[model samples]
Target: MGERILIAFNRTRERTVAAKTRVADTPASRAVGLLGRDGLGPEEGLWIVPCAMIHTVGMRFPIDVLFLDREGRVRRVISDLKPWRLSPWVWAAHSVLELAGGTLRGSVQAGDRIEFDG
Candidate 1:
């Protein structure tokens, strides 16, 4: 496990997306991301650094994904991604945020700025 942080949506006027986000910056942690998890709480999330794409091969539930640039600006948004699916590669993305399904429906989007804080 890495540092725990908070994810805030800047475009939404500092609205928080995930208040308890885990950092998956290690190879081991990134490889095991959400594989055995049944589901995520509304305010929980995983932040995988240096990842432009991801798969939900062993995930049991759906999730919402945010592809962000180095500065934490969202480059793309994949909503309600189901298990066993592969997300398209985002060339400009420097990290990915995986949240509970439907979490970003009306909250975040491409071009939205995000902030990570401990």
Candidate 2:
């Protein structure tokens, strides 16, 4: 597990969807990202900083991925990516958000601003 935090997506019309998030900022933490976990919970997520790509080779299930820019704005979204898939490199991405499959398909979108809470 990583450092617990709170994340909220500011969607259109001031709608925000919040979730319990974790930060994977260390090399060790980023290397071991969700590799050994059974699955992510409904509101649980992992945030990897300074990452532009990801792989699910060692994962047990599918996941939703969000590529965020420096200001926490969404740059791209990969929904329900199954295990063993490779994500495309996002040059503008400053971080990556990992969550349970189907978690953000209908709630989050590209260009949405995300806010972090302690």
Candidate 1 residue 95 Cα shift, in angstroms, is 0.1
List residue ranges in candidate 2 displaced over 4 A.
Answer: 11-18
Tens-digit lDDT track of model 2 for 4-105: 687655644365454778788899889999999999988888989889999999899999998999998989999999999999999999999898998776
Minimum summed lDDT over a 10-residue window in model 1 is located at: 1-10
Pairs with backbone N, CA or C atoms under 3 Å apart (clashes), candidate 2: none
lDDT of 1 by residue, 1-118 (tens): 4455665455545788888898888898899988988999999999998899999998899999999999999999999999999999999999999999998786887888888887
Lowest lDDT sum, 10 consecutive residues, model 2, at 9-18
Evaluate all candidate structures by whole-model CA lDDT and list the values in order.
Answer: 0.89, 0.85
- C-alpha TM-score for every candidate: 0.93, 0.89
Error of 2 at 63 (Å): 0.5
RMSD of 1: 1.6
* Alpha-carbon runs more than 4 Å astray in model 1: 1-3, 7-12
* Alpha-carbon deviation at 37 in model 2, angstroms: 0.5
